[model samples]
Target chain A: MSEVLTYITEHAVQWGAVILLMLGLYIVMTRGNLIKKVIGLNIFQTAVFLLYISIGYVLDGAAPIVLEGAERYSNPLPHVLILTAIVVSVATTSLALALIVRIQEAYGSIEEDEILEHGET
Target chain B: MERLHVIVLVILLIALAVTLVRLRSLLAIAILTGVYSLIMAVVYTLLDAVDVAFTEAVVGAGITLTLMLAAISLTTRRETKPGKRKGQRIVGAATAIVAGVALIYATTDMPGLGIQDAPIHRHVAPYYIETGPTETGVPNIVTASLASYRGFDTLGEVTVIFTAGISVMALLWRWGKDDR
Candidate 1:
């Protein structure tokens, strides 16, 4: 039991990421609501972020700063990428929401099926 | 390794499954999806992708969710209830299974997680690791990759975003209330 616990502790980050990814995907796939889908998308993206960062992690590594006598360090590339990604995500989401608002103004409801049927008429 | 963390993960999975299975309200689902993103951000932090996690937390859990919610506000939420659709589920399931299989096959040769000797470390990473220290003087490898080696890709992405914005503006201007 102790050994298993140790394993789990050692691999906690990995496990957390996998579980989050699965959850996000499930939400994106199964949820019927548009907002929910967006939420799921966010979740999915977060999982990917986790995956990338987790890859950069090094046990017993120092910060990715070069020093006179420092040994190994964790990679900093993923962090930079993630920052840019965050900005992009924010811009896209805001744009999407604006479009959605226009759509809502033109239509009466926010449900996907109702909008489709309405469009047919 | 505490039992609590494992239990929490299992519970999160189950909640996600139920959200997928039982929910009928699209808005509810979207909101839940945001929750899911927040959880994933936490996971990303655990995975040591601190930058990725930060992005995810802000964009995925925050901005993306807001945008999706706005989109839903403009459209219908629920899918049309099934009346005579039969094979849709089968198709979906088949596709999912196939995708899963493909993914598993792809990962079979993946370098073991966190192994420094992986090809990623040897062939791809070393160049960035070496040049970045003295040349660019930037501590962030990601910055080096984007701004130097893959600068063209970054320019392309920026162009795409610009084009998208312009397109949206054109569409809106052409279809505004005054025109109608």
Candidate 2:
């Protein structure tokens, strides 16, 4: 019990991130709505960003702005990497939304099951 | 105290996720998703990832929400209720649980919360930290690494963004003949 408490206290943020990740996955898996799935995907992506940023964190560290006498800074590599990733995610979301629009126009329905049924009939 | 804040924000984020999944109204989902992104941006800021937080605020909260709303306007606001498939839902739940457990197991191997001597901090990070300011003359190590040391990668990313923009325009553009 003591060990468990120690672990939780040390890694609370990471555990929270993991829970968020699972929630996103659950949303993606259960929802039948196309737009909802996209939103789930966004959530999933954000959770990943959280995990990465958490990994790069340093206790009592400053942001990666190099001041004259700054001693410790959080890992800037992850920040740079996440910047590119964030932009890519936005691009992906835009493309996915555009495709959703086209799907609606093509089948007159945005539900995944409805689109499948329309194809069958 | 900061950890407590992170916990609270994460809990709120989970609540928002639950709400998003329960709500079938597309407009509400879009709006909630925007709020979710904003919260995520705040979380990023709290983690000392200000650059990422700024980008998330602009692109994730702002542009993505606009695009989702535009898509919603083009389609029905309510999702059609499909016949419930209990088997699929069960399978999905099982998969998510298994994946989540595996991820948690992996986290056990990760370097503990904020140890400066972690493997990630030991690699190219040290090199960048030591020389980035001198080589690039930029105070922000992230900007220096992103724009100078990794110029080619940034260029490639910019190209990808440009291509995505062009592709979206092409996909949505209506021909003059169709308009008439």
Candidate 3:
């Protein structure tokens, strides 16, 4: 109905976040390429950051600068949290990439199933 | 309206995700990931989290993308098909659907975007917004909260970054000889 469409349109950002999260999950679960898995994880992490940032938005608010005439501001806590999270995400990406490199060196491949087969033999 | 722009960006994000599913080239996927992060950063700015948008642009789009490119170079850019697992795709889709449904259900009662009465706007955020400048002498509430009120947490975050640096160095650095 029109009412449902209106609500969906209003919270489009939140819905976007959820759908992206699911896409990330699907990529991680189904992708066999190790680098692809990492990409999926990064997408998943970024979607979460979006979810938090969207929560902090305020109506007719400016940036969280405590200046005169800026009567209202969005939440700053999520910004702080996600700032740290972004660094952590890159850290995770780096570590995972290094591991992927090592796997490639050891097993001569980066595919999950190939690595598993190498382990069995 | 401004909301229209956000809708367009969200649509672009979904379109990129679907393309990622179809793309087999690792380098192409990595580049698309960077584009995705950059668009996500713009969306953050529109939502008023400029600090977050800035960091995401740097770390997510910049550093993370570079790292992925390096990783692709070190490994193969060609992605081979998976073994014939009959039900993996179905199971993955089912799992995604279940989790997506749960998240959607949880969101049903959440305050709509930018509503003042939301619980997030009710508690400590008010304290930060009201007293940030006076307490920390920083016009930016995010900087004030990041540096002063939550200084210890920021320190912890720095330590985490430092740890990550150390870890990456340890893992990737060749030390003296080329092991590979």
Candidate 4:
């Protein structure tokens, strides 16, 4: 049972991440709403983040700290990189959202097809 | 206990698939996308990547959702209808088949998950794990790798971020008439 538990604990995150990524892709592909597509993009990026972080985990590992004489520690590099990623993501999202606002102003509607139609006219 | 987690994962995956397949509204799709990110964050926590998970939760879930919603406010809710074309369907199907085949082929020779003796383990990973103690004095292997051995990669990542910001500003900034 413990072995089973271990296996589940280890593999669960990957499976979940894959599912989320697939779902996000589906939204991006199928959704007509520009905003919804952006949301899907966020989902996709999140799935990647989960994948990287999951790779960093070590069972029973201590926090990445250099104590007097520690034997094992959880990897911290993924964490640092992730922190940077968060900032980047925020900046990108805000910029994208701002563009959307401008797009709305230029065209009466936000629908992708409608915008194209408006442009054509 | 392990089976329970696996079951939950399966359920989540199923829900995700259903959402992808059936949803018609673009706005609903975006919200579902945010939920997917949140689920991914949970997956990261389970994997023990606490730091990465925290970042994902914030950037993916919080910030992303807000931005998408703002986009929605600016745009219409409806998605465009697909044009009638049998050729398009055939092309799409063929492309999807090729992608699936490629993915399967790529995975064929891949190492099993978490195998201690995988090539990645033998390569730079071991070097970092072994020398990290003396070189960076950092306990976290991931941190040491990013901040030290792979420090260059981190720098590159930062550069990318800077570029992205500049591009966004350049694209979004408005010209003023007061200047001249």
Using DockQ as the measure, the top candidate is 3
Give each model a TM-score: 0.69, 0.95, 0.96, 0.71
Off by over 4 Å in 4: A1-30, A46-94, B1-7, B10-14, B24-27, B77-94, B170-180
The deviation in Å at residue B171 for candidate 2 is 1.4
Q: Could you tell me the TM-score of candidate 1? A: 0.69
DockQ of every predicted complex: 0.31, 0.77, 0.83, 0.33
Q: Which stretches of candidate 2 lie over 4 Å from their true place?
A: A1-6
What interface RMSD, in Å and to 1 decimal, does model 3 have? 1.0
lDDT of 3 at B56: 83
Chain A TM-score of candidate 4 vs. true chain A: 0.86
lDDT of 4 by residue, B1-180 (tens): 423453475468457756655666667766765776677667666555666667677777777776666566556565556555456446544554565455445444544334445454345554565688688877666666767877887787778778777866776567674642
What lDDT tens digits, residue by residue, belong to model 4 across residues A63-99?
4545657555545656666767766777777667677
Model 3 has how many clashing residue pairs? Answer: 0
Residues A72-107 of candidate 1: C-alpha lDDT, one tens digit per residue:
656666666665666665666555555655666677
CA-lDDT, candidates in order:
0.58, 0.86, 0.88, 0.62
Best by TM-score: 3
Model 3 chain A lDDT-worst window of ten = A5-14
lDDT of 3 by residue, B8-120 (tens): 89889989988888799999999999999999999998989999999989988999889889888999998997779659999999999999999988888888778877899
User: Candidate 1: where are CA atoms >4 Å away?
Assistant: A1-56, A62-70, A75-121, B1-21, B77-80, B171-180
Looking at model 1, how many pairs of residues clash?
A: 22
